[model samples]
Target: MPLALYLLALAVFAMGTSEFMLAGLLPDLAADLGVTVGAAGTLTSAFAVGMAVGAPLMAALARAWPRRATLLGFTLTFAAAHAVGAVTASFPVLFATRIVAALANAGFLAVALTAAAALVPADRKGRALAVLLSGTTLATVAGVPGGSVLGTLLGWRAAFWAVAVLCLPAALGILTGVPADRGRRETSGGPALRVEFAQLTGVPLLRAMLLGALVNAATFAGFTFLAPVVTGPAGLGEWWVPVALVLFGAGSFAGVTVAGRLADRRPGSVLAVGGPLLLLGWPALALLAERPAVLLALVFVQGALSFALGATLITRVLYEAAAAPTLAGAYATAALNTGAATGPLIAAAALTTAAGVLGPLWTSGLLVAAALLTALPARAATTPGRNPEAAR
Candidate 1:
């Protein structure tokens, strides 16, 4: 592993913390801003929307620049956005800050993944990408929890301030650690974007990757809204919320680690098993949320399986996009962000009609099932000695 990969991971840790820490402080933010909890939750949605829209746009626009410079610029933007967010008192102003921050976040992640791929041997790519993405898992386990504690202790505003300060170090790490590439590869007109899009859409493997992402998104949508569901109907306490989240994060970390190894050995098999396991785990998770021990056990499995599938899907995309790897990396980020944006919205609608959280959980389970079904066709299409790029 390169030292640069570690630095990139650190930057990802800070970015993930800044993006997700808001969830832990939502109630506090709502109270401080005199808004409802539903409204406060939009802060997170706002960031997701930014990522969904900004990632592809930024990637397209930065095609001509050196990868190092693009990454550095995005990291600086991330730090600046967080700094502004920390100081703002007005609700609208803070929202705008979040949007800017998310844009920066999206661009940084898109570039970081591409850079990670560029830094390693093709055979070792899955492991390199896993190391970079681990920062995100670590954020869920450590950064969000720590930020929540800090927000409670120092005030929500202070939490943002801490993230802002950390960004300075993250920015410095990127600037100093990432290697410079002199090659300036320019895409020809809109054709480059169109070509990549066509390749991704045309490839069966890529389609499967997108389907996997969509299914994952749908399940996550329900899971994301789990706190309200568990607390309102399951009769769980707010404290239990963090416990479940922590358990979920722990499972996710384990899954990512395991999936990386599996992908190296049998990428197709990992995708096959992971998708079904995720589908199976959700129902158990929903049912068990009512029982402390059962809920903890189920949630852990749910998190682990979800993350393992996530890792598998990521490696699958990289393999599919090997022809236009940079564009593929950007598309993978875009597809996942699209899922992130879509999942919560779908869950919110389901929660409206159904009696309780069960509706969303069932809906999420079905999505996972659909994703699993799609994988069968995907697996069958794999050809022996097929140059991976042709699959793209």
Candidate 2:
């Protein structure tokens, strides 16, 4: 509830915009860089890979640094990555910038979640995280679509520069607003690898992570290819692409809002009921891609359900891993980014098939359906209804 929490969320907004804006920029980037669209889609995966690795690695390395300093460094690095990306003429150079940006994004997010939880009461962790994640949802509404519009008009480079410039104010806000004394007690040695491994391998925590990652994998798989879907198969104009993104983003904002209210109380029921609905959406979107109306309608539905389930699963991991406060952020980052990375990569491969852009939707459908096995035990949560009260 503190202003610092809002500052953290503001920083998250900039990060979220950069993280997701690529969905819109892909076609332009591919044409400009003289690569196949599938190759361009790899940029999303590249960023995800960086996040998956950088989250825990940076968390451990920066454990001894002041929280404010750590955040500032990551923010600056992220901003610089974008600046470099905007100017790069080579495809591989642009690809490398995405990795660096993702690493900075991952480290900041890994620390941000822990810092957010630390700022709020145990009972309020769910809502606090919701506020933090709202940045991403909101980015979908404004930033992602805006990037698409800019790419359509000014060029993809403009969007990248915008993201870089946005970070300047966010960095300033974090540097000043997050109090000097508001800190994680520094340790000479990082969190033990054994404890970190135990936390990851533990059944409940693992389940939470798996469920979260599966939902995200499915979500991003479809999301990464949304531009092509709207413009190509759906036979809409470039203008309609951002319109579709707006609908998805608006729905996502609503979903995360509801999840924040219920996740802490009913993590099981949330995932139980939401998972199937989320799964059903992908195939429906794919099968009906020719219908503009169906494509528009399902995009919103999928975004809402996918993110509600994702936010819940992610927040739940943070709660389940409460014993290891220092490692919690890293695990949270890894869980979320693992799905983000896997979904797009698989979907990108599908692009080369006869299905073309529609391949990502089928890819997402298959991934989530398979991911269902990972959440087999999450089905049991439907009966329990609420997480254990003591965990509060």
The per-residue C-alpha lDDT of model 1 at residue 240 equals 63
- The lDDT, on a scale of 0 to 1, for candidate 1 is 0.71
User: What lDDT would each prediction earn against the true structure?
Assistant: 0.71, 0.86
The C-alpha stretches of model 1 lying farther than 4 A from their native spots are 182-194, 229-237, 357-359, 381-392
Clashes of each: 0, 0
Per-residue lDDT for 1-392 in model 2, tens only?
A: 88998998889999999888888988889999999888988898899999989998998787767899899999999999999999999999999999999999998998899999888888788898999999999899999999889998999999999999999999999989997787754564545656765787677788778777887888899998899999888899989988999999998999999999888878777777887787788989999999999899999999899889888888878877876777788888998999999999999888889988899999888877876777785565323333445444
Candidate 1 lDDT tens digits, 130-212:
89878877877788767777776777888788777777887788778877753234565424666766766556556745775
Q: Say which candidate scores most in lDDT.
A: 2
Q: Estimate the TM-score for candidate 2.
A: 0.95
Instruction: Highest TM-score: give the candidate number.
Output: 2
Query: Alpha carbon lDDT of residue 205, candidate 2?
Result: 80
